[model samples]
Target: MKVLIVEDDQFHSTFVQEALVEALPEVTEIVHAANGAIGEDEARRGEIDAIVMDLQMDQRNGIEAARSIWAERPQSRILFWSNYADDAYLRGIAHIVPEDSAYGYVLKTASRARLKLALRAVLVEGQIMVDREIHRLQRRGTSLRTRLDDSEFNVLIDLALGLQDKLIAERRGMSLRTVQNRLISLYEKLGVISEFDDEVTLNKRVRALNRALVTRTINIETLETAHRDLETWLAGR
Candidate 1:
């Protein structure tokens, strides 16, 4: 079987390659792509049997690349290898993954054996193998009390980036009032309104961001990624 490794870091890519060589004796050809953009191009060739995808990269992120790949080839098996188990990443993956696709999410810190197991489960056995921590976060993300829908999550990202509502609406192609409404929903789900007894006195944006950070709903990495993406968007606009 052929496998593709899509990672920015050469060391991590080699590590995964070595693990795959050790674990899957049947792996015949292993292709490598240094970033998600190149990975997407390689994947679209329709030659690879499975892919090991890194979450963050320069040209594109794993979710974006994978979404495009799945759009063309829905049956492609992919193993998401990443350092982050952030809610934003999980939500992004959930939004794009095909309903019947075989996929897995394994942390880069996972043991070699565990990585091999996940690879086999996804590529060979055609099963889903999400890390236990990611599964817990996924559950929490779907829970009604804490659930942040896609719209709310987009607003949360903008809020974390310190974008004013007007700027956010312009960036997101939504009306100012719609951005504010999403923020209100975000604040409610994050319990920001209740956390601050006097809502009139507190900055809900800051409070909600604090709550999100404390809950690991969003993190420094998520913000950094969003900031980079925002810059790219602005450059194109």
Candidate 2:
């Protein structure tokens, strides 16, 4: 069986290559791509049987690459090897994966045995393998009570960046009152406020942001992406 490894870091790519050789005796050829853009091109060749994909890269992200790959080849098998189990990454993966695709999400910190197990499950047995922590975050993200709609999530991102209600209103093209209402909804969804709290003293916005960070709902990468987006928005305005 032929395999492809798409990772930006040389050390990690080498690690995966060595591990693949040691673990999966059936692997005959292993191809490597330095970034997601090249990985996408290589994957479209229709020669690779399975892919080991990294989440973040310079040219493109793994989700974007995988989405394009799966669009062309719906049956493509991929194993996401990432350092983050952040909600944004999980949500991106959940959004793009085909209904019947076989995939795996394993952290870089996973034990060698666990990584081998994931490889066999995805590459050989055609099964889904997700890290336990990631599975929990996925459940929470999909839960109706905890799930933030797009508008609420946007507001949360702005708030996390220390944007005021008026600024968020301007950026989102919403009335100030509407932006405030979204904040209220966001706080409720994040469990930072309650209806019975008639005499609230704590800063709801700060509390909600803190809760989100602690829960891995919004992480450093999420904020970094938001910052870039905000910069683009500001430039256009």
Candidate 3:
């Protein structure tokens, strides 16, 4: 089997290669791409059977590259190896991946045995394997822990980025009234409106964003993804 490794870090890429070689005897050709754009280019060549990709890269992020690749070849199998278990990354993956495609999400800190198992599960056995820690985080953040629905989370990010409701509505393709309602819900979910005193200088939107940051709900990685997505959206317009 031919496998492609899409990783920017030299040491991590080499480590993954060595692990693949050790675990899968049938993997004959293990090619490498420095970043997601190169990975997509290599994938378009049609020689690769499976891909092990890093989520964040300088040229292009794994999600965008994977979306482009899967648009052309929906059956392609991808293993996302990353250092983060951020909801933004997970949500982005869910949004783009084909319904029936085989994929895996493994943390970079996972053991070699775990990595090998994940690689085989996706490439050899055609199964999905998500890291337990990631699964736990997803569950915790989604179920009664944050109580911020996808729409609310999105509005929170927009608020954090200092976007007005009108601009957010335009960007998100939501009606202005809907954006206002979402902002109200977000303020309640983040407890910004109820928890803060009237004397607080910042408005509810700003307070909600600050609360999200303090609670570690929305983070730097999330903001980066938002920025990248905005750029992509602008380029497409």
Candidate 4:
């Protein structure tokens, strides 16, 4: 499979590429771009099979690049990584690589096995692994986002990528009822409880939850410490 890395930080880009190579050496080509503008250009070329991208950049930004990729290369799988595990970026990536069709979000503090599983999922069309913390937050959201399981969260993000629920179900092996339930739960948790209305309220609630999860004002050291312990345990294997 072919892969691309679009990140501004050279050290991070190289380190991620190296780790991915060690896990999957058969990667036919691994292209690296330092900014979103170039990444968008490479994506429009339609040669890449998969992408492992960064969330932040000086120009074009990962969110905008992801939007372009979704429109141009709907077939490719994507794995988005960032130090910030905020839902804003998570939802941003969902716009390109739907949860069911080979996509994931990982925090920089994630374990090696988590990264391994994320790449493997996109490559093999199995389950995409996201940051465990992100998963917890997805479940905590009050809107259509909270009702989704990890798999559903993946599909919902994929929906943000312009996929229909029917298509997402076929890709993820889930039923339509399952999908609707997830959406209902998400809306209730997100405080947009009026299912009858699909207006600005829903959008506002979603944005609020996404912001709460991603752009936090509180200390995350406790969560960071927990992740560190988990990483130590996983790497020991």
Residue range 51-152, candidate 3, lDDT tens digits: 999988886888878888988888889999888777667777777789899998999989999999999999888897788988786677656744777887
| Cα TM-score per model | 0.73, 0.69, 0.83, 0.57
Q: Compare candidates 1 and 4 on TM-score and give the better one.
A: 1
Instruction: Give the residue spans of candidate 2 off by over 4 A.
Output: 136-183, 191-215, 219-237
- Extract clashing residue pairs from model 3: none
Q: Provide backbone clash counts, one per model.
A: 0, 0, 0, 11
Question: Per-residue lDDT for 34 in model 4?
Answer: 92
Task: Compose the digit string of candidate 1's lDDT tens values, residues 61-93.
Answer: 788788889888898999998886777777767
Task: Give the 10-residue window scoring lowest on summed lDDT in candidate 2.
Answer: 133-142
Off by over 4 Å in 1: 136-185, 194-202, 206-237
What tens-digit string does per-residue lDDT give for candidate 2 at 1-237? 989999999999999998899889999999999998999989888499999999888877788788889999888899998987677776667767999899999999888888888888998899988888666757866577878887888899999998999999999899999998998887888888873377768888889999889877777656665777788898998
Q: Model 4, stretches more than 4 Å misplaced? A: 95-100, 137-237
Model 2: how far residue 168 lies from native, Å: 12
lDDT of 1 at 126: 93
